[model samples]
Target chain A: MTLTHLNARGEAHMVDVADKQETRREARARGSVHMQAATLALLSEGGLPKGDVLATARIAGIQAAKRTHELIPLCHALALSKVTIEFTLDEAESCVHVEAFCRLNGRTGVEMEALTAVSVACLTLYDMCKAVDKGMTIDGVRLEEKRGGRSGDWSREPMPEPAAATSRDPSAEAEKPAEAEKSAAISPTSGVKIQFLAELRERFETAECVLEWARLPSRDIAGVKLALINQDPKYKALLNQRVLCARNEAMSQNEAAVAPGDEIAFFPPVTGG
Target chain B: MKIVINVQQDAFNTEVEQARLTEGRSDIGAIVSFTGWVRDFNERPDVSALTLEHFPGMTEKALHVIAREAGERWALQGATIIHRVGRLEPGDAIVLVMTASAHRRAAFEACDFIMDYLKTRAPFWKKEHTDSGSYWVSERQSDREAASRWEHS
Candidate 1:
């Protein structure tokens, strides 16, 4: 059976550029990951037991490029000439900046393949370190530049500032190698680079904050994951918090109970899922 | 004629393209160049490092695209792209694209055109590890907006 505009269930389509060129082609793409200071420290020291975060992510990025078809369903597998992944320490924000570049000599452009590499790399880091920090975010995955075929020449727009990804003093971080050395004993790895994230501390709030079981003696709040129905930019950071380890309070389902005059109704679980 | 992509190699720094483009003849008036470096920040002060990833078959394809684009947009004699991959420190040369044109305007504008589009549309993801946690640079609306400028112009 031949099917167009459908891959399996909903609908799918494959873009064909078979009539194009065999000219030399290359693309430069960049994306970024925002992480906590501790997480950055662990990565720099190469302390995470799961593996070298950057190395593994590097490998994953390549694999993701190869498997973009599987993940995205219709991407064409092209013979890639080269793949390069790099990591740079951003000391000011305690984060790592990842840039991926892919190349191929084929009919179709490799933008999706390049993007897939960046996406997979970020996800791998998140999966490996979600235990410690929850504010991790993936950003700026875009086509930095591309060349090849009938499209002739195409480039990305200029950022407001060339150093759009700004941060504090990271090069000086090497000065305090002692910090990394202290953590080195934590594992066979050498001392980790003690990076620092300089984001301001944020506050989390919710309209329908409630405990799952208000009546339980132990406060049966273990299995529930926190959710916010609607959030403005001011509190969007709250969504980034994976699991709050703080001694936070949760009211019963439906609505939280207020003491004293009991003027407000506690936020309850959404009426619908 | 010869180009290289380096990662902390002890071999050379010969920003040789300058001499190479000029070659034996000194008549070539302009050599436009762009050198992108790893900065210390990523919007948040806690960012400590950056990790760049690429697709093996496609990485070269994309660079070629940028090179070809530079050629098409300007009156170019020759151009080369040298982008390093792997772990890099702050101040390291992340990418170098150079164009040699008969006149300064063609070389300079072509070089700027290449970099402008590269910054916004290139499909590479950069993940920053900060003190607070690790996060991906959100896809920039500004980047899209920037790229859009070329479409109308």
Candidate 2:
């Protein structure tokens, strides 16, 4: 028979670490916040109003590391040595990459602390910008690396340092159907999803003016306007050179034809989440 | 060995867990598991279902790390966890935490520890889906009160 403070019930308790040795332990984890290229661009450009998204998120991550146990029951409290969060701009997809590394000297590893840091950082980003970008998502928050404990310095990936991406080259790969599919599969609102419908509307409506495409370096640039009135001799030379990525699903054979005086609205697809 | 993380999933099982936590032991004294199910009854009645989203990678890592921490603090032979994701309904197993130890004290300690971990650390955002529309879960006094106890401990 089990004689203990808890039975089969939902209760709160801290993990007892009175007997565990205090050793130097550290945990490094990485998590990402995937946003629309437009959203990302806005973030990078400091268009977000919550006052420095990265700065606030970084501070939030550190605070989260220190409060891991308070937020999680059964987690033994320990002295955290260091908690650092970094952000990088991925120009390709227009997403902010948040990475957190947490260190501690205690009986157990700091994996939770590190993970907590990343999660809070992402949440902080969401909170700061949800007013403008509610569809933002946090994904792939995994242990990039860790050290100490019986497992002995284990990690699923390299000891990733903190960074983000901002505008890669506009390569032909941007136009590949497969790349668009892959981006949608990972997180449906990036890359081509953000711009497909707008492109279709512009093309079919014979809409005048420059059209911003979701081409490479997408996060670095906004939608361009095309002037349909002119032969657009310049745009003719740039055909298929660029594309738009929006926060929606990929277009299925983008085709649009609009009669005179027709108005078209392009919006991001509604996500299940 | 019992693990708990804050996230949402449809189902979790215990029978299948016994094999996982006690795989090595005929010597195990007792096994304890605490499974938390999504109750159909909330403060509101019209709640048809709920969907939970989380900082994916961070959520799992937080759970694993919490579970491992509990195991180290309390002597446990083994632990297992099952956390669900995506849309879920009432009566769904949101979390499953089980612990095995040489004696009941350790098992019980580990089990309690895991539940506590679930309440506080996991980065899951809860949305209550009702006939009206989707609403974010407001802060609950009970959860804060429960978690508050550990803050001082």
Candidate 3:
């Protein structure tokens, strides 16, 4: 694709949008700042040294969005009808999610403005929290979506998991450290464990029971249920009710295969919101 | 896809949950959310309180499965499912489901799909306290049918 903001000589220049139609356009951008859990708690409780980190960040984001054109060399200045900067505090990850929205009826897209807002917001957060958490990291800054303009609407697709760091070099694996820290979700050689949950536990009176792999009649959930019933007739209650089964934390049908050291759970249908 | 699943006893802020899905990303063109609240009348009008019980580890796993399936079905950028357990009074929020995508339809449908599957597949039992007594809430046939429709579509 040809560059829109460049002349044939390749010198950067803003494209003339005078003839472009005035249409409603909207854009959103997001980013995050990771910090210590204690830092986040202090910020949330208004105990941060900066007095109010989120409020300051929000104001900074809005101001940055309005002045995006001034900061960027070739961006066209358009009056944004609305600019909203929002934040979400994540306790488990000790991070703050920042989002910005820019909307207007104009010729140019506001994606850059929204992105600028989020970037400034994250930077402001870092500035306010740096006193307490010097190692905070600001990342994941990107445009979430845009609507209107001649190119039409666009949105980001789901991101794929990051590629393994050492996988790029095939020889690195041979020299890598021992694999003792491998995934603990699935362990080999241990016998299958059956777990009863909620109402099922109340009826069965046992939270969990293990079965030897070699003694099982089969390796499927149906077979496991039969074996469990043989051990205790009360287990037959599960068969009578609309019991649901899960193999290794995923919903599984009765015929789903199971291996040694796998976790199996049975419960009734959910009535949650 | 970014998926966040939380099963806790504390209340969740809808706006914060929405921000969790949309923040720091501009590629989402549309977002749809559904919040379920504890109504004063469910099976009876004089209900005073409700208690939600769920399988601890399995609850989060089941919600993850549901949210992941929604992400697979739709071109979703992010999804969140927060379900509250423990005793809840009337007007308390019980669950929140949010889906972000490029188009309104995908976001709307994914949110609906998550709620439908969550109601039937998630291992949560609700017991409502009425004027007469408290009883374990029964699964609705409509919820099952709602979830089944997605399979054919």
Q: Pick the candidate with the highest TM-score.
A: 3
The CA lDDT at B38 in model 1 is 72
RMSD of 2: 24.0
Docking quality of model 1: it rates as: incorrect
Name the better of 1 and 3 by lDDT. Answer: 3
The worst-scoring run of ten residues by lDDT in candidate 3 chain A lies at A176-185
**Candidate 2: stretches off by over 4 Å:** A1-273, B1-10
Residue A98's lDDT in candidate 3: 95
Model 2: lDDT of residue A251: 17
Q: DockQ: which candidate is best?
A: 3
Give DockQ for candidates 1 onward, in order. 0.01, 0.01, 0.28
Per-residue lDDT tens digits for candidate 1, residues A42-154, read 66555566866777899999888877778777777778887877665565767677767788788876777888888888888787777777788988777665656544434
Shift of residue A26 alpha carbon in model 3, Å:
57
Cα deviation in Å at residue A166, candidate 1?
26
lDDT tens per residue, model 2, A17-85: 678777778777788888878777557556667757778889989988888889977676768877778
DockQ of 2: 0.01
Candidate 3 chain B minimal-lDDT segment of 10 residues:
B65-74
Candidate ranking under lDDT, highest first, comes to 3, 2, 1
CA shift at A199, candidate 1, in angstroms?
42
